[model samples]
Target chain A: MMQEPQQAREAFRGGLRVPTSGCCPGWTQANLISLPREFAYDFLLFAQRNPKSCPVLDVTEPGETSASIFAGDLRTDLPAYTVYDHGEPIGQRTDVTDLWRDDLVSFLIGCSFTFEAALLDAAVPVRHLETGSNVPMFRTDRECRPAGGLAGPMVVSMRPIPAERVADAVRVTSRYPAVHGAPVHIGAPESLGITDLRSPDFGDPVRVEHGEVPIFWACGVTPQAAVMRSRPPFAIAHSPGHMAITDARDSDFLVP
Target chain B: MMQEPQQAREAFRGGLRVPTSGCCPGWTQANLISLPREFAYDFLLFAQRNPKSCPVLDVTEPGETSASIFAGDLRTDLPAYTVYDHGEPIGQRTDVTDLWRDDLVSFLIGCSFTFEAALLDAAVPVRHLETGSNVPMFRTDRECRPAGGLAGPMVVSMRPIPAERVADAVRVTSRYPAVHGAPVHIGAPESLGITDLRSPDFGDPVRVEHGEVPIFWACGVTPQAAVMRSRPPFAIAHSPGHMAITDARDSDFLVP
Candidate 1:
């Protein structure tokens, strides 16, 4: 068990490969997305326009490996990375040092894991955690505001909470706006054009028990969906569920 | 008096040049800084690093005439614009339609005016508004975190609040973090390297009453200071005290 974010990053840097979900319990985890400098401005605009789905934590200068939030070398620090060629996944690798480019710009986006922790702390049960499965994510029919060449449906991560605890969940997560914040939709997945709750486009679907409501929050995977739909020349992202554990604590993002 | 933000923008678009202070009272005002595309990423990163000094409200795509938050044409909507050539102010114009370039990227940053209104609403006396003087702004000794070719000292706006209402002023302003937020310093002009209360680097000085304490909040003018020091080849900004009245309501920025 990694006790600190730096320890987790150091282990990853030394060639250890593992998902970062439970590591460094109180620290914040970030979603990674790197793109060529040419595509950076448009993507930044996309994140700015759809802030709920793509709450940015840190953005590096073109080709810079380290951001203020994460001091490790980005090329080798993450547990795993998925490389995309014109929106198609070309390969997944534990280290991307060989593929590093000076013109590539990296964005560190806030992850729902931070808010999930808050939800759990508030006594709102997280279904996926109990079942030991990935949180289910779906592509909604709603279109995000287009920016330059990027456009796609908003992707949302869903969790099952007791109907009575819905308000508590919203209150807990609302304090972490840097992370997805509050639920985008509750109860009716069909309203978002999600035909079936058991079959998600990304991540594993968890069981929805009796009296539990399906609540969805804007997912950080949103930018990846945009990348796939828009087909940027090249891009890279952390494998779903695998994240960069940052030095910042979950409380660092909590608003008063 | 313009009753709506659009009306104020229309008046400016029609060449009515005047400071935007007190216009569209319930609307949010923004500080404009249009830079060539070459400087966009660095400036964006600079804003990310120094969020308090430069809270980005909206960023337009290269050469975009308007943003979602401000539906008016950027080239002619603002009351006045100061064009800069290698850091020096070349001219102030009512319209920049002729100088508008395809690669110019505009950043609409949060202005202190929004929180000032909040402060006034909370019954926290604002000295500048009472005296009909521009808020005094000073370049502080503290340097903002530099980002890729942009480096300069932080600039702060000073307000004199009654010593008893300082806590109320802080609470009211803190609710609107998007607009410079709470006071960065309270009751100490000399602490920020501001030599004298009467002599400010920018804007007009106001009298601090016997029972009033001078409070300082991060100012939007910090970016202009960076442009001056970094010497970017070209830039455009709102002339001092003249702002771009945005369509977003002041309430839209209030958190919690």
Candidate 2:
């Protein structure tokens, strides 16, 4: 069924723009990006330098409607998206709605599913889904490339894998670098320069087994790291845990 | 030299900050992080989630004077640094003498040298030094994990490496996870959703040889990506070419 972005957005109403991650269970979820025209070139350049932290999905031409590669319309595809002005949350509505601009650019990026399946295939249990808790994250001593008016830190999402499975975990996850492949830091938050595990930087804490080591992956939060410090004038994003589900699947991004 | 941060800053005032890379040589060349207290937690959390983009060097205790890691002091240390408030450049001062705040928190994190040396050891040539230009960067269709109230796209830096050296580059670099390790994306800008390579998103463009595939690494600029989009009320950082050099060395962080 080829439904228009606006029509798809309208169908969900207040319920639409919600994360489309689960809409198509087997499909991948992507991050959404909306930016002004002035910083477009620089921002695009920045993303290229920092792929793991900023996996590029689909981009739209300035003031254009459709995506660079993926299908669906930029203005109406997602059921929900947020709007920002001068780095402040001005509103949240399904679709870009009245906020679309000639200078605005849209981007979609791959999520963690590509590697998760690999982990699952390797029989490495992802603790969060088992316990139904959010993965624990910590700020480490890592940095990302800076460009234009963009700069800040790198973010990561950690999964607690069993001690015996750490090697397999790394092997499996390394296959998909597009959606954050491999662990940035293996164990000991302090080694990554993290002090506490109970208090996570983002998301809820997941249970770490007694012998398990915390395996961290570059998360989709690198952009958020910049906003908290620099506070760009305008930005919009999907709500936490809420993501855009793409027509693509995890198997599409495997390196092997 | 066991000099204080402020004292080290004084050295830069005497034309010492020039060619600042590896200035303290072995010291940690940190990407300065200064943000208003209102956004402190979110940013601290943002750094936690996107450690690669915003690593936690040493965050100044709120209203307290001094950093906990990397540098001995926040008043000064690096050869040079910059400050930004509300998405505008107020000034680039050798010392943050006039703008020091009780609420401001300073953060220092690991830099790429920890991994760059690995690349060099593996015989990977870094071109920016030869070309005397900034490493080219671009935006990617990627999203970092969101923390606090911050979120946006990912930014990255690029280097052209011979295709044969790719495996070595990944292997050598992967040993140092503290700094950005491993190539995020290897070749084909469009594959990562990047449309251009000559016109970078951040730094100056470097040369790409006939057989050299563009080898990209996670950059320190990812945080700037979020900062620009979120536009926190107040923030400070090392100017594009400037960094806070700490008491660190590239060899100290390698995995055996």
Candidate 3:
């Protein structure tokens, strides 16, 4: 039986710590990041300027744990979290209830997992999912638009698709603008200053078959990258692949 | 001869005060609203929650007078501005330079003027444009999703389209989601709590011809309505239809 988003969140709240890739199949999964109130404005402005890389799903008011999209307690609902201090990952925890502060502002960002399902449903192969590996992510030469004190290079995830299915993948994913939308780069990674396909900056490299071409889409990890570089005094983010499964249906973000 | 966005701003900077309709025809015009840094987060969140009512085009840093979308000095560029003290209109000015402050954050919201051109291009008759009157806008009974310190009813602008051409209007305007996309209600004004079409809360009402139906789209004046109701300590907005001409072209916002 497929677990509902609430059930999955309950399990996590009860201390189930694991990656959330295939959990709650039809529901939307989101990347979670919390920053102190002092830095929330700069980060929000940064997301506004670089929308493709940082498609915001929902934002919470200061000290609030839940948003309209995710009704569970944000401090304990996710499988795993990384606590950051001045840009360095200080530690990982299953829950951060004790460390949560009154001035913390949480942001839920759209994740590509929503569109990967769309791609597969449209018969476009998602290599990473088939191989049971994390998608390949790379830091590119392109700099994101700077806002206030936050700035960083854009990070993108790559998927290998048959040349014939590239257009179909673009069409299917374009409908979900809330989740990174269409390919940022269709082919030739070097144009974006990506030197080697085998060595990605983050995640596992997947097999690119003979007829397959590498396609890139803006990654949700971008805000984390910015946090890592900008080094704000305090921040919290979901562990790389462990996301928060929200109550929103996949079709909610789809546009006609 | 047509004026470029820069040229239009130059004229406004030189004290040309008038409604911006039909000015810089192909360029996009945006509604301007500036508030103190204290209220910026709540308003940005309000916009995020109610995207249909507030399609953000660009937002400037506190004290910053320009954005990438609008390159001219915001303090002196727009034709006219309305200053508010605790939400009550205090005065109107051609240039806000004397009143500008470093902690003031400005938001550029998408205007229906962009999609109105698209409607005209699709051969949909725009009654207000034809009759040389302002577009009719009303405060709907429906409430917008509230954010901290900001809450109000949704506001909509009405245009009467020939019954047969209503579908075409929706298709054309839906492509420009940055501006208010598609009509919220079609045919009946009373359904939206608007008792009469002759008198509107804002703008001059136009005659609805026979065989035509009234269509309502989310209006750019919404943020102003929110400001009026929320009663922020200080606020500045474009004098109704007197907007800031942006460098972005209408086609820039059209999605496939």
Which model scores highest in TM-score? Answer: 3
How much does each candidate deviate from the true structure in C-alpha RMSD? 2.1, 12.0, 1.9
For model 3, residues B57-150, the per-residue Cα lDDT tens digits are 9998889999889999999999899998898989889999988989999999998878877888788988887877777889999899998899
DockQ of each: 0.49, 0.03, 0.56
Give candidate 2 regions above 4 Å deviation. A1-256, B1-10, B13-15, B22-26, B63-66
Number of backbone-clashing residue pairs for each candidate, in the order shown: 0, 89, 0
- DockQ of model 1, rounded to 2 decimals: 0.49
Q: Which stretches of candidate 3 lie over 4 Å from their true place?
A: A1-3, A14-18, B1-3
Per-residue accuracy of model 2 over A59-172 as CA lDDT, tens digit each: 655676655334555566666666666656666666665777787766576666446656776789987657655556556677777755777677777888889999998888
What Cα-based lDDT does every candidate model obtain? 0.87, 0.64, 0.87
Q: Estimate, for each residue in B63-118, the C-alpha lDDT of model 1 and write its tens digit.
A: 89898799998889999988889999898899999988999999999998877767
TM-score for every candidate vs. truth?
0.94, 0.49, 0.95
DockQ of 2: 0.03
For each of the candidates, what fraction of the native contacts does it recover?
0.20, 0.00, 0.23
lDDT of 1 by residue, A1-256 (tens): 7878888888988878766656677899999999999998788778878888998899888899998899888988898888989999898898998988999999999989887777778889988877767778899998998888999999998998999999999889877888888888998889999999999987888888899999999988898899989999999898777789888999988776
Model 3, A34-62: lDDT tens digits are 99999888888888888888888999988
User: Largest DockQ belongs to which candidate?
Assistant: 3
For model 2, how does the per-residue alpha-carbon lDDT over B58-82 read when each residue is reduced to its tens digit?
5555554445445344555455556
